[model samples]
Target chain A: MGKRRTGTPTLEEVAAHAGVGRGTVSRVINNAAGVKESTRRTVQQAIEELGYVPNLAARSLAGRRADAVALVLTEPDWRQFAEPFFSEIVRSLGDALVDTGMQLLLTLVRSEGERQRFLEYARGGRVDGILLISVHAGDRLPDMLAEARLPTVLLGRRSGDEYVSYVDADNAGGARTAVAHLLERGRKTIATITGPLDMYAAQSRLRGYQDALALAGLRGTRSLVAEGDFTEESGRRAMAELLERHPEIDGVLAASDTTAVGALHALRAAGRRVPEDVAVIGFDDFPLAQSTKPRLTTVRQPLEEIGRAMVRLLIEEMEEPAVAWRHVILRTELVVRESS
Target chain B: MGKRRTGTPTLEEVAAHAGVGRGTVSRVINNAAGVKESTRRTVQQAIEELGYVPNLAARSLAGRRADAVALVLTEPDWRQFAEPFFSEIVRSLGDALVDTGMQLLLTLVRSEGERQRFLEYARGGRVDGILLISVHAGDRLPDMLAEARLPTVLLGRRSGDEYVSYVDADNAGGARTAVAHLLERGRKTIATITGPLDMYAAQSRLRGYQDALALAGLRGTRSLVAEGDFTEESGRRAMAELLERHPEIDGVLAASDTTAVGALHALRAAGRRVPEDVAVIGFDDFPLAQSTKPRLTTVRQPLEEIGRAMVRLLIEEMEEPAVAWRHVILRTELVVRESS
Candidate 1:
């Protein structure tokens, strides 16, 4: 880690690094009306090199800084914000911005039009920085923001090779641990519930499940798999469908705790005893894990830590653009509980 | 109801409605940094008369509009955001902002210093508007913001009348219904779990609980009453404490589902059969309500609607500054399930 600057580095250092006119550096750094990007980049490069962290406290005193940061969540489902997974991140992000004495702007870009508007707000300097989360397939928000040279950090990684700073959990490895636990239990007829396939997290979890089954020489039967949108209702219905298709299945692994909770309900309704007739496990050991009957053995995503990590990465990127883009994969743990 | 504008309205209309000059209207609306109160009021009157709304979109074409809004929640507990109450509001707030083509920024503040910094950002025009949720006692945030005359609205009522707009549910009525349900079940040894006494919601819920007991002519046992922080663990612990204090207690009305779920766990662990040994009811019909074993009979807070209402109130407050501040109290309903 680089030593923290005593104060924002001098404009002279910025000018020296950018290799531009002192006047040009002043114009760009000040965001003075007529500076071009070529000039802006020179100034940005100079600022970046000189460790010129915009002092929000001093800036607030002057009321000259943009004084705001925009949080761009590219959610395919708008309501997922109600889900604890997303809310935790927002809370942390908000807390971090408060420390900087910066206003936080949250945007949900569900459609292409929303994304365009978001770009306008972000690029127009309405926000000094951007934080992106839950990017889906064909989502171009991250790329656009990065290409525009906006300081951005993502909550999760994008699949593309482009260098982007992000913080994510080891989803595939976590799923494998979950499935392997069921395998070692001698539960032969195990089924799985997957999240939306378009999402990489979902895709990775599914892949891990498949890899585990292949290693055990178990058939990846279509009947043993069902997809859910990570809600308990969907989990219950999926479990029901899985039971109907493969009545002899003895174990289940769900993508989330809420889903697993639903599965438990379905199993109880079907007169199946947990860990006796059907052992069940879930991911993201939410508070509901303990709340559920027999409790739930699930994968702990370290979501709060993930939130903290994302903020840290975003702060790093904001402070040093030349800093290497990072993929900080937090480790996941398997917590054994009554059900599994 | 007023018609939503398709685009920006004429400046003349704003000036006429505000009963001020075109120059004054231009200065205030454009945020040109200097305008007297009387002149600004006249301009605002003219604009209101002309049915004018500032053309942020048009201004953004010049790359100058700050299209982001801030949702500042004065909550310290991390678990509070984990609860469905805050998440639901955040989701609805996101939806409402999306519809209006504004970005939402979320921030958490607990201390006086943090509050001051947050207000500084808002006053600096970092965000187009502000949404404040003050959960704890003696939170002067709403009053401070309102006094600063920032475009602001509260999620719940403040201690004193401050001419600020707000949206809240009928918490007292909801709690009353919950307790009443307990009495109807023929459970005479009724007990209740109250939320934090410092909060108005908690106080109101307690009032409702008392109201039901009073109407039923049943003794409100001091030993049977417990207080929880609206968490499952707190609920569980409170239930255990209640049982230890009053082993003969046969009915319970918990302040939140999380606490109720905890109570359920405690009851089952203590070898007490639910409904047969003791009846349980909780508030906030979160997903946990239905997921609970025997299902938790709870009071539905219309969480999403409350969130939507908060956004609507905040938006209206921004649109019409002198409009009568509204205190919206949406109704709650009792959801009967197996628990009681």
Candidate 2:
């Protein structure tokens, strides 16, 4: 508790206060597991009492890692910012990083200028690795990071031939399972509301729907498939269009739960009873799925598992830069409720 | 782009590629405003082509700022993590920091040990400032930060007499306005579902309800108040308890929109008509407020404005450390809808 001669208390002062060597205090500060529990406690107490603040910049300059990871959001649309998917993934990522002693730096790169700025920031050794989410097709940020030899992991792939490290859900397989379930329930005429075709996940989902129909020896007509942007309004519009073209449609699969909610609204407006008139299934089984009227039967993506996998891959790449890029796709489950 | 003989491309190579001086390249890399648009483009192309990455560690060691901010979440409850409030605030903060070239480092400090770890991380000079959210009353992290001389800003106060810099919405005023609105609608016996009183925001909201009733020459009875923890389940339990205690209650004020949704569910279960039998008002006009059966009337906190203010104050403090800590309180507005 003595007044420091300098501006802030040093490691030496903490060691002196605890009657230990400076190296012991350093070991404790670094959270080295080799230190004895009792000695670590005494050093921690002295450090807390003395208000010792370690200089990370100096330590990093001395060849220690920055011990931080950057979680970059590459999507520019503000509407996606409000989606439950984003928050869920972020929370899961935070949970995965809880014990790693590595902080998550959230950055939004909207334009080319901002992307360049982020590259420089990452290259400057501020972060040990990067986790990217919502990256669009043809976005060169991933390739740039790869060329720069920075360790990076992406939430989803840009294409089936994506060379960068990524963790993706079984979007196609989930959609196929939903369609198969609807088929098993004696629904003859089926329709689908797909997400935007430009994205790989959406394309994969559309493919799944087609594959399921083909496997059942049925051809999916063009009129029965409508494109949506994964928003509620888009879903409503697509659903209305499908109903208009084929009023006998007995089954519908939406690319996302939000879209499914919109579809439900449209169906209600048309006085169609859920399951009795139109069996509906949604993807991403968000919390809203359980609260909707009739309760949506949807496909639940293993989002937490995806987040953990992303972190694991990024850490591996950071620790061993020569490691090959990895692509991990986690399985999805069909959650049955009242809607189906 | 010349072939690099050593490790990665250097700044000098980028300057040579751009046909500019090293200082000019540095200026462009730092995003200095002095560079012409055309010159900036040329320098940028060179940097991109050469894949030159600046050493931020060296730059920071030479007295340059890290140009990064740390956003610390002190709340440990996983349920709260799923709330829309957290995502909205984070998006707003990201928007505010867009043009500043400052990255947001998100750190969750759940335990005292993690709090100490965060302090070391912040003090290590990885971030230029810190923004704290979901801090509970009597938490000493703020004081510890102050003693460490770190430029920090809190989303809400720890207490009424908090000395740290903070930006908060008028929770009490918002609640008062909501209660007043219910009374103006000729609600005779008003009850309230309160959030957890351990938090300052919840306490202020409860006081606001009492103040509004007292101002109207009516005493708030102890039997009319039920405690909730801002969760939908808590709201439902509290509302059911309140109805049992006072079945003749004609109006109710909920601490949050989530709580109000629960109240609405309980009223429906009891066969009570919305505006005709029991009018209800909620705080925090979340998107869910609009999707409710009766479309809840609620108080709208200026969350985006609060976020912008926090960033502004932190940047100011970072620039001028000697500036006195400022407390900012933004006004809230009531959005009238169908429920009340």
**Model 1 TM-score on a 0 to 1 scale:** 0.64
User: Over the stretch A124-158, how does candidate 2's per-residue lDDT look in tens digits?
Assistant: 88888999998888799999999878999999899
TM-score of chain B of 1: 0.79
Candidate 1 chain A, poorest ten consecutive residues by summed lDDT: A56-65
What is the number of backbone collisions in each predicted candidate, taken in the order shown? 26, 1
Best by DockQ: 2
Candidate 1 lDDT tens digits, A32-150 = 87787677876786676554643333343244235566777777655565566766677666666655645566666767877877776655455567878887766788888887667
Q: How does model 1 fare in lDDT?
A: 0.76
lDDT of 2: 0.88
Task: State the weakest 10-residue window (summed lDDT) of model 1 chain B.
Answer: B56-65
Q: Candidate 2, DockQ to 2 decimals? A: 0.42
Each prediction's whole-model lDDT (CA): 0.76, 0.88
